[model samples]
Target: TQLLEQSPQFLSIQEGENLTVYCNSSSVFSSLQWYRQEPGEGPVLLVTVVTGGEVKKLKRLTFQFGDARKDSSLHITAAQPGDTGLYLCAGIGNTGTASKLTFGTGTRLQVTL
Candidate 1:
């Protein structure tokens, strides 16, 4: 079993600021997914990175996959109060006929104006 860990369990920033969150694991993952969860709601998918060293951008947010597929990072530029939420990274691995998802400890972000 692979365990994914995220740094800075809590983050508080002002509006229009920039921040980066990290996710790391010792085992390699076939694919990695990032999600954001707001209060009283389930997490929403942000992005998925399948290729090593690949980077994907979503509006003001950027997602990067490590070259070894063992780590990933999410960067939010000009963060808004609406961006406040719980960020989670999930590692997906295929086990024969089934796929297993291991989620990180999670990072809670609060953006205040």
Candidate 2:
């Protein structure tokens, strides 16, 4: 079981700008998921990628999984102040009934108008 790693611990950008966050791991996973979180609330699942080389887009957000299933990326377009929050990536380890997820360190984004 490999641990997920996220880059750019923090990011500050102005509204209308764009950014991409990355998640990497040494071990391959069955699936990868991205989430957004606020200070006082639980994380909200943004996207999930299960197949290699698969890409999913949600409005202005794009999520891509590496061909090897060991990495993923999240890209945001025209970021808005409401997009500022904690972003997390989680790799789902397939262990049957004992399945577990390895979460990335986390990336905090601040979008200013």
lDDT of 2: 0.94
Q: Ten residues in a row with the worst lDDT in model 2?
A: 93-102
Candidate 1: worst-modelled 10 consecutive residues by lDDT:
93-102
Give the whole-model CA lDDT for all candidates, comma-separated: 0.95, 0.94
Residue lDDT tens for model 1, 1-113: 79999988999999999999999999999999999999899989999999999999999999999999999999999999999999999999755556667999999999999
Model 2 lDDT per residue over 1-113, tens place: 57888988999999999999999999899999999999999989999999999999999999999999999999999999999999999988866776566889999999999
Candidate 1 deviant stretches above 4 angstroms? none
Q: Which RMSD does model 1 reach against the true structure?
A: 0.9
**Which sections of candidate 2 miss by over 4 Å?**
none
